[model samples]
Target chain A: METSVLKSKLQSYRELALKGINHYVPKSEPRKHLYDLVMDYPSRGGKGFRPGLCISTCKAWGGNEETAINSATALELFHNAFLVHDDIEDGSEFRRNKPTMHEYNNIGIAINVGDAMNVLSIKPLMMNINILGPELTWQIFSEIEHMVRQSVEGQAMELGWRKENSKCLTEDDYLRMILKKTCWYTTIHPIRIGAIIGSKGKVNPDMFNRFGFFMGTAFQIQDDVLNLIADEKAYGKEIGGDILEGKRTLMLIDLIQKLKGSNKSKLINYLANCRNENQLDNASWVLDKMHEHGCIEYARKVSKHMAGAALKEFYTCFQNVEDSEDKDMIEALIMHMISRDY
Target chain B: METSVLKSKLQSYRELALKGINHYVPKSEPRKHLYDLVMDYPSRGGKGFRPGLCISTCKAWGGNEETAINSATALELFHNAFLVHDDIEDGSEFRRNKPTMHEYNNIGIAINVGDAMNVLSIKPLMMNINILGPELTWQIFSEIEHMVRQSVEGQAMELGWRKENSKCLTEDDYLRMILKKTCWYTTIHPIRIGAIIGSKGKVNPDMFNRFGFFMGTAFQIQDDVLNLIADEKAYGKEIGGDILEGKRTLMLIDLIQKLKGSNKSKLINYLANCRNENQLDNASWVLDKMHEHGCIEYARKVSKHMAGAALKEFYTCFQNVEDSEDKDMIEALIMHMISRDY
Candidate 1:
């Protein structure tokens, strides 16, 4: 598809996804307060990648857009739920370079607002039982629940390591944390949910699940790379934001292993007592060190490999369906996500 | 009805609720540290009335005690969820007059622990679906959802009043706040849940709802009174704690209404800035003035009336029931709650 056509389709889906969300919050005084609090954080802007992937991946498997949007709305809600709590956890005051919900609203009301959003995330599915049916509702709810647990588990693992002052961290550990925490929860659950519910629960679920896992991993690695090296103005989140927060991303871990002497000690100390003024400088130094050691190239290679592996998996399972359209859509989306210029 | 027998039941239920709660946490290495953060917060010492009401009310409606215990455990977990966030909001350093979960553990990990407990609250019901089934699970989940909404509403109302510099709060306004924020969510929901879920969810839900409402109001009033005049050592929480926090309990509202002159100004100013240690003496002096205004007696009367009304509601529906054993047990439990022998 042409860029303009693809962009327009994505725009339409964004409107549909927002509409799906607006209907659930209802126009009550109290409900509106909650709606504003939640949507404020996530809707400032989006590449709309999560919801788009949800729609396209479903279309890849011969699913329609409408069914995909409900799951997509949930994708957006779950994504923002992570945003709300993660912002609070990381103490990042900014999202889209604007003050985060908790920091702007103050933590108490923000906490309640987040709690309400989480519960409200399920409300749409509950109310849509007539449209979605109880069985599909249960499946979607279960998928969302499983994703939350995995993300939280991944976070806990990272926090545990961060607290214990342990530097025995490895690339394997970093990958596992990112995969469990970010990968599938963001990608697979949304895709699998779209596929499963769009199929009206007729899909075997396992194929979508496998497809989501590989794609989601690819999606997460790209995100880590972008945080280190993307144009901050376009991304709207700071390029070195993760380093400022001492996040245990692949780039940081890889750089640590490859750097030597005072460079390594400086990076370690900067991470340990990280303050705002020094964070970006430290992040830049670490990035340069990683490049010097070829770790940046190595990280890029890993990201491509993950995306390629997922594309290979998609082809191995469904490429020979005798319909070129479905295969073309899958391959196009995979290519676009993996190679898109942000 | 004897003290020893009541003690045994409370003790037994507490033991079982703990065991069941431990089982729900699920031993995953990554998440165990987070679980430990929740487990260590004043563990093994809730009075268990919330859970007890769940099971007890269920039993009163002709259901088994085990399901009551399960429902009770669920309520306990959910309440802890509210407390964790509330503590952070209120800057509460202590719970049960000891270090609160967040203060004992850092806020980040404690936030996750509380969320896990909240999530775990519903998991036990899923496990109990074999005994209670899907319909009942839906009912319990719905009831829990409603309580969460009301609690948010209540919190909003209190924060609204606190932000208002005007000193024109009525007893009615205070009562409404407590009803939604503290009473219904804390006491009534658990009571009704225990009762309804007890009859295996086939009980006279209407009767239990009213019973829980009255009892919940009574419980809040008693808590208000206890906050003012209860024995510091025996009560296990500091006296005049509500007044110090500038919380709009019935006792403080009554005193604020009836007072005039320097005392009124003192109370108002103390409330506006009572958050500091330097304000403690003035805050205590204001509490003393509240005692002089008979605010304490007024609060105590309101509490007794609510409890009496709750008992009347329980009695009116079940007076003609055929089971003498259940009738006696119900009578015994209600007495123990209202009585202040210590």
Candidate 2:
């Protein structure tokens, strides 16, 4: 499949998912302020990749887009809610090249908005009851339960690691964290939920686990790389923001291993200090060290390897299904996400 | 139905609900810190009023405690989650005589813990599939949907009121806010959900609404009065915390009415200022004025009237149902809550 064609397909699905999300524009007069804050990030428009993937997976599994739209919108809403909280926790200033929710509003209001969005997200899943019946809706609900639990657990690990300044961290530890944090919510659950819904509970959800793990990990590493090197305008986020936040990205873990003596101690001190205070100097210093040590290239290579493994897994999982545009797009997404500079 | 007997019944139900909640003490290693923070409030032991009401209501409708335990535990967990967020938003220092979650942990971490607890709370509700089966479980889920939506809407209203400084507020406004915020989650949904489960989804949930509204409102008014007048040791929370937060309590509204000219302006100035900055001196001055202007007495009268209405509503709702220990205790709890000094 051509990259341009795949991009167009992805855009169409994104538009469809956006339409589904517009169903919940939140018009309650009393709490309109909180609801307005919730629509902020979703309206700013990221890749819409989460919902796009969810809808595509459902289509590829022979389900209509309408059947998947509610779940897809839910995926996007939940992701944005997580991002709103994540921005506050990381003390990041920008999301999608705009002020983070807490930066635009106060932290208290931002938290309230995120909480409301979370509760609203549940509405769509429950709506599945009318469309999918009780048993299937219950299964999807349980899957969502696991997905939320895993994502929060992953977030806690990352936050705990930074708070404790855990120096014993390894590349494997970073991978494990992202697998729970990024992989499950980002790729695994979306595919699993979509597959189950599309197949009308016929598909074995566990079968998609390995493929989602590899694909989502690849996407995350590429994202980390883009944070360091991509133009801020193209990336739609602050360049090198992860280093400033002391996020345990693979590049950071690799750089830590390559550094010796004073460089190592300097990096350690920066991580130990308050991220908001040290962001600028820390980002520049870390970026320089990563470039000098070839850690960025190292992470890129690892990401490509993961993408390759994902391609292989994709063939195994989709082998039984008929060829379709949605299937092709899913394959294209894995490649595009891994290889894109922005 | 004597006061002591009612107290004993409430205590036993609280113990059962606590045991049920103990089943979900969150042991995930990566996020144990978050889970531990969540358990802190529930373990420190507030009255256990929410879950006790839920369990007893279930029993009164002829349901076994085992059938209600999961939902009861979920109610407690969800309530604690709200407390964690509410404390941060209100900037209170104490809950159940211990530091608030944000006071013990950073605001960022406390927010995450609350979010985690909110997610963890859903697992038990999902567990209802095995115990209650899908049809009844879906009904319960629908009830929770209303419960969470109402609670957040109520929170948004209260927060918006403080933010906008709505000086033309009436006692009717206070009632509307508390009805949404306190009454629904505290009384209405619990009885609705309990009756539905106990009657195997046969009861009309609407039947419990009026009864719950009056009972919960009476309970809330008594709680507000206790905050003003109860001894610190007996209250188990920071006395005058609500005044310090400039909460639009009935007594506060009454105090504003009783004051004249400069005193009214002075109080308005205090309410409009940042609460955290004004908490100490404002609490002292407001307490004095409440005493001087008979504001406390006025509030007590209103609360007593509400309690009387609740007692009448209780008989109307429960008269046709079988007379049991649970029913008798529910009747006694109304008088006990309103009449207690501490």
Candidate 3:
């Protein structure tokens, strides 16, 4: 359960998944604009959380690493694809310590690259048929179908909220949004898919839902917190980006609910301004208000509670499975969610 | 097939596919920005060439109407998704006589809606499980996977060409680009899928590839010609928009190849300018040159040749199959391709 051990385990799984991802990305023509850009975000080191969860859960459930590699690679590709489009949608400037795809290239090229990544991801899933048989492969496809639908629906909610600049969001709304947006693909489906592959589709995937929801939400909260507090170098994203984009993180929602009258109106007006405009002064003011109102501290406390629930659910979900290093890694992952710096 | 009869048959097929597409689009919350937008391009009353080809081929191969609906619907959804993103990428102002999605909504919302449409398309494919069983459904998924990959690669080629403003493009290059971009999804896979379903996977889908390529390229060439000459109201798109976008159509390439000295430099400069800039005089001048240099007539001649080849291919590909209305309709559709104004 030591931090170094978990980090190494995650690193190893990431390398394996990256290898699979690289193999799938066609190194043919149109290299400069298309295939090369498809490799950009994936090559920029992510924590590999999705792939780690999928491969580790599969290993923990008595499947060999090979059986899950294609699925794991597909998950990584999908994750990177989402990040590429998400960066464009959020108007993000930095990713993994580099200019975002849309910033480095033009928006059109970036969008097409994201689309190519989506198309490339399908190859790995199709490869799953040879290893997992048609029935299980089809099940994985269905799981992917649900994962994509939920993620988009969740994205629609958040994008809609920002467009409307809704100031009346609540904790429950935040939870539901993250569950659909962050949890389903990031945690729930990865775990369910890994387990399904590992257990040959015998294990009930529904059993992992609550565990993934709690774990994934906690991870997302911590990520939001890290965006505000972590070193810009370590975080690999611009600090206060969520604020600039007016993302309705739990802390922002809590701050909205707590503030009143003039201060609240000022915050609302600040958010209403175009993201392209200069809003540094207003952004810093909002951050200062968040600190003064204990929004950051409140979010951290809620994240810890979610992590605790994840731990409990993790035990129930994996109680019948035999213990192994992968299981230990997964447990360590849950514990590490609340403690990591980035 | 009489012109009116062909029109009615195409309309009926389009209606059937639209019904299937509507049944798949969820009527849930987040309707305005997400699900509603997902239906926007589909409901814009496209020609339904893809669905019609797919359904008719299926019926011609002795398959029932019910068996082909899901695949046809999925193809239409994919087509619409492509249009939504294509409008954004091309910076197009109008689509089907209305503002492009990105023009009506912001680019961010437009991109997300396109992503949602891509996600929604998967449902119908997955629904194929009970009806077609697992193996054939997997085959269809593989077809879709190839279709999408080819389409994106083709798009990347076109986008890259515009980005570089390359003037030395050849007829072969144009053919290669549209083969991947237009033929694969627009014609090849649809017919292949239909034949596969109709014959219960016994037919060779590859046999339709040349037929599709010839038919689809001819169809695209005529479309380009119509973009310049079709009645504004009947065409449902801005006349000369392709010139504004600096699209590397056959006529444009022909014009480039034929022009000399100052006129060539002038055309290159005109193309190098931003699409947002006013290029009315330059566009008209280029169109005038295309006429004087016989570029438009050259393209029309090429289209007729391709259409002739497609007709020959149609006979060869369908030689073994029994005579039916669907088969005759397909022949009429090919004949209609190089003839229609819209």
Candidate 4:
């Protein structure tokens, strides 16, 4: 019952996302070039997780769905905005198994489109001034600006680290980088913003932030593990893509520690050299060795452990909810995240 | 007495133009590299007519000098931001007849610098929270973003026109281009923002806006004239540079009308085939023909006419000032602009 409910809500949000983006462009434009740029990839149906969570959070805080929709649209726009630029910066030709924006169109126009989306993202909030005060408007903008600035800084720092073939970074450093680059923008920001608008600052919003950080981290680790064992056809992205880009995943770190001599050197060579399709066999061979060494499963256990921390908070919040049915639904959703293979 | 007083006030703005740019950059950066970028012949030691007018307009609106200074700094940075990108778009090797940013550094780093400067332009405004409200802050951002979008559109339009060799554009069309690319960002927006910040809904600011618009249009016309006759040595920029690039200035428009038959073909060849010493000679020959056709002097007269219209508005405002000394100073400044050759 919970699974069916989540699916319908996800579909509704997806349609709203399309409507939100389409409404921004002027009818006078000779052709709908910008909208066409966004909807070009049809296969990439989103899970709508960040936005769905945002909606749920807004409801959790007792904010009106209509009021929160503007914030949700902003989140969706920002999410795609980063995807556009990130694809270019990383020089990834494909996203969701289709050519990236810069690849499909030229780089110059892609850059323009990314910028336009970023601009359009804020237009929603700016237009909704009847509900916003001067302090709150500045508050939201300052938060977004810091998020974007830190994300860019994190990307630069990670690229610097990657250049050194840095597989030896401590877990603390890894957590800091991912939290800055992935979790903060992806989860906590959207959830907390939704909660704030819902409660209009009523609830203890700090707990939402704390739980979101761990859940997002757990989700990221799941993604990192999926890069190895996940079916290529189902994943809709290149297999071992992170290792191809020389990203220092937890599995890679563990594998490095377990191997030595020529085995280690060969693994490093495969990790560093993603271009040689002939060496892809060796890369896969290394992946198998990591599984055999218990490195991959060990990383998955860690992810589950982090997800457990998030579930603890969810149950605490659920116990205090006046509506038992909503509390039950929230717990079921949390359990699914921890248990689901996907 | 008023006319003389305005001259010194205008000069005062110029004398310290570089000081703020210097102060903002940390001393830890190689002094030579920093100096080389800012102190380049094209960028340095200018009249800063745009920023000067902005500062003066702010003062006239009863705003303090401190509030105006940061706004003026933002204006200068904004100007350089355009220059950074425009040089790349136009692809000429020089700016102010010296090497362009990309030529001095490289395209990648030059682009990064331009991006950094754009981001930095807003930091000063963040310091203005106490004086202005969120409504005003958002308005200013919208204005800047609007200007930038139009400028890029104008650039794309110009590129299309040049590529297709479209000669259908008129004097009105040229005005629209400059209005977007120059007048809006440089003058109109600054004036409106200053008024908005000062008045803060205190009073109707329509008169100040009209005053600024008229002055901005006049300032733009004067610049077009200077592009033709100013000494390259004194201006630190190329004379007839726009002509070489086939920019449809007012003089170029009149020249097209005046030079019938063979001179028209000669002008087109000189402009379209803009390369090498001999081609430059062809351009010079066309300029000589424009002089023979009296187009040069005709453009100068038109500029003076525009300047006169601006002066009329400026003078009316001057007469209304409560203090006679302020009246004198502003009138003096307007006269200085009218009389100056460069």
**Candidate with best lDDT:** 3
Candidate 3's residue-wise lDDT over B1-342, tens digit each? 997898888888888889998999988877987998888888889788999999999999999989999999999999999999998998888888889998988888889898888888889998988899877888899899999989999999999999989889999999999998899999999999999999999998999999999999999999999999899778888999999999999999999999999999999999999485999999999999999999999999999999999999999999988999999999999989999988
Give candidate 2 regions above 4 Å deviation. A276-279, B276-279
DockQ of model 1 vs. true complex: 0.46
List per-prediction Cα lDDT, in the order shown: 0.70, 0.84, 0.92, 0.62
True contacts kept of 4: 0.00
Across A86-175, the per-residue lDDT of candidate 4 in tens digits comes to 675555666776778777665444554554565566667665565655555555566566555445445544554564566667667777
- Candidate 3 regions exceeding 4 Å error are none
Error of 1 at B309 (Å): 1.6
lDDT (Cα) of model 3: 0.92
Give the alpha carbon lDDT tens digit for every residue of B147-257 in model 4: 555554455445445544555567687666666556667666666665555545343445655555555556666676676778767655577776676767767777776
What is the alpha-carbon interface RMSD for each candidate? 2.0, 1.2, 0.9, 5.0
Q: What is the lDDT of residue B80 in candidate 2?
A: 86
Q: Sorted by TM-score, highest first, which candidate order results?
A: 3, 2, 1, 4
Candidate 3, residue A183: CA error in Å?
A: 0.2
Q: TM-score, each model?
A: 0.90, 0.96, 0.98, 0.72
Residue-wise C-alpha lDDT for candidate 2, range B38-121, written one tens digit per residue:
678888877767777888878888898889988988888889889998888788888887788889777778888888888988
In terms of TM-score, the best-performing candidate is: 3
What is the DockQ for all candidates, taken in turn?
0.46, 0.64, 0.81, 0.13
Clashing pairs for model 2 are none
TM-score of model 4 vs. true structure:
0.72
User: Can you rank all candidates by lDDT, best first?
Assistant: 3, 2, 1, 4
Query: lDDT score of model 4?
Result: 0.62
Q: Residue-wise lDDT of candidate 1 within B43-65, one digit each (tens)?
A: 73766666655665566667777
What lDDT does candidate 1 reach at residue B74? 72
